[model samples]
Target: MCNALAFVEEPTDKHAKSDGYCGRILRAQTQGTRRDGYNEFRLRVEGDPENYQPASIYRVTLYASSPSYFRGFTLIALKEGTEGTRDDHYAGKFQIIDEEDTQFMTNCPPAVTESTPRRRTRIQVFWTAPPSGSGCVILKSVPFKKILILLQQLLHYYHYH
Candidate 1:
């Protein structure tokens, strides 16, 4: 069994905008499978409801106490015939466990559609956890530009932008 599994932040209006936007981990659960365990997580990013940019991209990072326990990661299943491809929205693997953190970007559209202008976008991810371990995980989200700089420093890679 996992030792500590909790949402990094509760979904609320107050926490909806820490800065220009607010990133919250809405849910995280572990499901037992025949071969391995699946750690499912849901993250939401909220911007100004009245002035939110649907095309805006956000960078999300997942930190684990035992990084090696996470063998693989995949975004949750999406609706068929969706307009966007995972490659179109997903930035792919940024930093792996070797760097003590895992990072990715949400370049896709919001999973949930609102009748009116809504401030929030959400995505689901599945992390393959080792069969036996007691590790904790935490997540954070920030603007893509900031994360790009940080990734360059952490990864020692240069980006034209």
Candidate 2:
């Protein structure tokens, strides 16, 4: 389920270099003012193949498993319809596991208005660079397609418990 993944270096913000698309590893070493290799990536759900749009939702999780200093990370889900767009939709934040690592789980970061003629869907995860210049960032893979399934399971578990 962790196949569909895209690694981008600060696509939205101007702090880091913009590494358009380069699979998992955006850069092997940091450089210039971009001393931080931090970045944000989107897990999109364009909908079914046959039908143009199908009812859908997303579940996003951010996990940091590194041995260095990390400021924090934010996850946001934005939606754009035939009419216009949305704002800084804060999904959730990663928990500071220690002085250097953290993890986060969004029960169901706001849903996209499927009936609002929404053409595409995306889960954006943003990360900050480690202060120690350790050049170490570890993140678990998030499957783009199974977002609905994972969200359902999370919701059901939350309600059931």
Q: Estimate each model's TM-score.
A: 0.22, 0.24
Steric clash count of candidate 2? 0
Error at 75, model 2, angstroms: 7.2
Per-residue accuracy of model 1 over 1-161 as CA lDDT, tens digit each: 33222222221111111111111211111211111442232333232122212233333333222211222232221212221233332221222222122223242222211122212233223232212232332332221212333334423422321
Tens digit of lDDT per residue, candidate 2, span 102-130?
22433232221111111222323233222
Q: How does each model score on lDDT?
A: 0.25, 0.26
lDDT, candidate 1, at 59: 36
Best by lDDT: 2
**Over the full model, what C-alpha lDDT does candidate 2 score relative to the true structure?**
0.26
Scored by TM-score, the top model is 2
Clashes of 1: 0
